[model samples]
Target chain A: MVVAVAEESRGADHARPWIDQAKSDYWQLIDTEHRLEDLYNLVNVPQAIWIDEKGTIVRPPETAGSTDHFRRMDLKTRTLLPKDQEERLAARQAYVDAVRAWVTSGKHALSANAVRANLPRITPEMAESRARFRLGVWLRANGRAAEGDRQMAEASRLYPDSWSMWRQAADLDEVGKASSPAFWKRVQALGDKPYYPPPKF
Target chain B: MTKILTPTAEHDVAARDGLWMSPADAERVTGWTLKPEGMCRAEACVPLPASAVGTNEVDLAAFWARLGGPVIASDERDVWALGAPADERNATLEGLAAPDFTLPDVNGVPRSLSQLRGKKVFLATWASW
Candidate 1:
């Protein structure tokens, strides 16, 4: 029997097609359950945990399978360029391969700390940037548009090229009454990187 | 050192629920922030719009509803409050032993986690919206 955990955020609607494809291809797809606000708890996508017959977590949290809808050209060698894109792509590919290995070999085949040890180190700046991002989201959600914008601006300064940051800033601007076309344009100007589409309202 | 509140704390407070949280609460306890990403104590991060930085409160309703999260509400001081369980379908706490829960499937038949015991359960989540 197989149980699957689907961590859904606002934009998860866009992932449905790809998830369906994964179910058809790799997994038996027995049960699909949704976890709300799970991303904030689970941190990474495609996280998988294996439970033994006694309901003990046999395998700790690990990055599981992923859906890659984009082609090589879509991610690599894309139009608006960033030098880090290549590195990011390579890391993703490697991570995917590692997950595939885990699925095929099971827990015994791989060391438990293998995945955890390989995770990228979190820098103080990155942590601060993430905090500011959350603050911005919280502010906008609570109807504090200007405060949210300020937090978003700080995020951009810290992680200038992050698609996640830009997308968020755009969301705040679009939702609040203070939203402006110019703000949307600024978000668009951040240039196309491989960004997960926002969930439809 | 200044007290730091987990993302979840800010969220709970912003939601107007009196889910009390102390500033010294560890990230793991709150399950609100992760090492690299913004997750709660359970190490889950919902990809919401925002940089995951400074005082940004995510729209919990939007994020949870999209993810099919089970909305659990409580009333404190005459205000209706809402919170997303660690497990949406099962409504279990994170990092703890899985709780015994039974729910009807699309066919309206009841199923429980205990029934699936002994087999390695690979729970995968999905949604329509």
Candidate 2:
């Protein structure tokens, strides 16, 4: 079974059209509070976690076949050049093949110890940042925009790695700010660091 | 009244300076009720430290901090958020058990991760942005 979740603050208001377009028979959830982020330590989107029949996590959250090749795209054209697009597709296909192997033969599933070691570590700052993010979201929805923005900024400072938090806060301020030049600047700032670390089996 | 935020609910409760709230308010904000022994929810009980329990109120921030959860507040102290305990939040890392969550689908029907326990699940998350 496949369960897809749209982690949007506006919930169905923002995701309904995409959900409708998918036409998926599987469960499609709308998360307004980012429950998965708080629970699974997810930092970005297009991530997947594999669970087995006993509810054990066979795989911790990882990039679900997505790559950072978009960083090389032409922003003005908003398109990835053919070569980069092909490489991205190949990576996605490889991830899908691995998933198929796991489902069919449980060949790639990680042992419990391996899963434990691979789980993302929740640092003190990260935990506090998540709390501030939640508080900021609530404050913004409850008529405290300036205060909310402050809390969100503090959250971003505390956990610089959480592009999800920063982007969502940007989206709240301006509808297109998330994909704006600022996003590119942040990606460029990564320098040698990875935006989407490769998934480990 | 200060607005208290929890994972599943929010409440406006009376507080006297900082985050010290009446036991009743604490119980309302968090499902755990204050009793003679300690704070309790369902069958679990956690003994509160002396610093966390005041004359007739509880220092909610101290209580949650004792449980290794982050406690955040607004500048004016009008709003506060009590996060999940670090132990509970990171339990999946140690036990390999996927944490269960219930969320509303696009059609507004509530669905739970546990409902798919009998099968292999490819739990994928994406965003509209």
Candidate 3:
């Protein structure tokens, strides 16, 4: 089953259109609050975690997009796009190729130790940021917009590298639009950072 | 009806008819569950006093405060915001298991990651933006 962990604020209303249009058979769960970021240690979208049947996470969260994702446009337009586009794409393909290898190799895939070592590095600061983000989401969800903004801003400040958290927090200020110009500016600033930590194969 | 809010889900828990869903709702709102020991998310567990659980309800404020995660309550006592426990979250990072959580589908029916244990889940989090 393909599980889709959407942002905390968007429920089925944001996702149902795409699924309905495709007539998808798989499960597309909606996250009303955006809790998946903390649990999965996700900082951005199109990231994935590979878990074996034993309920153990084989591959930690990392940027994994189809090569086609980058083929269409130049990174110059998509300011949020990672700077190391080709290098990241190669890493994504390597990870995909590794997945194919794992599907065939099963328990014998590459080196288990290497996979185990691939878990995303979560520092104490990250944990605190996640907790702050959760509180921010909850505060905003409960009609306390100002408090929510304060907390979300703190979370974003704690981890400026995570565009997801930053973007989510920025969305709180918009009236009707999806994002404000400030969000794009933030993305432009993040254009040079290790936006998506290069995938590990 | 108590409204439990989380980053991914929200639940209006009615008075229990047979099974008490407060803990389930709590876990849905936060990644922690009320086990026999206490509120548990993964390898870590926070022990709650006997008073925290009533016959068919859980005190969200009490539970939240006890968990040692930042929690703020509204004046009306209807809404509560829960923060993730720092130590438990750190343990989750250390253990490397995605914390289990149940969320509703587009139709508002509940689904959990644990139920799909044997299947390969390509969980992707996206938004309109």
Highest lDDT model number: 2
In terms of lDDT, model 1 sits at 0.41
Best by DockQ: 2
* lDDT (10s digit) by residue, model 3, range B1-129: 655444444566652422235676667666677778888888988787887777646665576667655554444445544556566565675675657888888788889889988766556666655
Chain A alone, TM-score per model: 0.42, 0.96, 0.74
TM-score of each: 0.36, 0.93, 0.68
Candidate 2 per-residue C-alpha lDDT over A1-201 given as tens digits, one digit per residue, 9 for 90 to 100? 889999897558899888889899999998888878888988888889999999999998999999989989988888999999999999999999999998899978988888888888888788888889889988888889989888888888998988888888888888989888998999999998878887986
Candidate 1 lDDT over residue span B1-129, tens digit each: 112233243332323222223323323234444333434445466554453222434344343333443322211121112333323412232333444544434333456667887665654443322
Instruction: Tell me the lDDT of candidate 2.
Output: 0.87
What is the DockQ for all candidates, taken in turn?
0.16, 0.76, 0.36
Kindly give the stretch of ten consecutive residues in candidate 2 chain A with the minimal lDDT sum. Answer: A7-16
**Candidate 2 positional error at A110, Å:** 0.6
Error of 1 at A62 (Å): 8.3
Off by over 4 Å in 3: A66-97, A107-116, A121-125, A175-181, B1-68, B72-79
lDDT (Cα, tens digit) per residue for candidate 1, span A1-201: 554433322233444565656655323221222221122223333455555556655444444443223222232434323544565466567654643544566533323344334323433344445555555554555566686677667755766544335444654455432224453454446466322321111
Instruction: Please list all clashing residue pairs in model 3, or write none if there are none.
Output: A5-B125, A8-A32, A8-A33, A8-A34, A32-B8, A33-B7, A33-B8, A34-B7, A34-B8
Candidates ranked by lDDT? 2, 3, 1
Interface-residue RMSD per candidate? Answer: 10.1, 1.2, 3.2
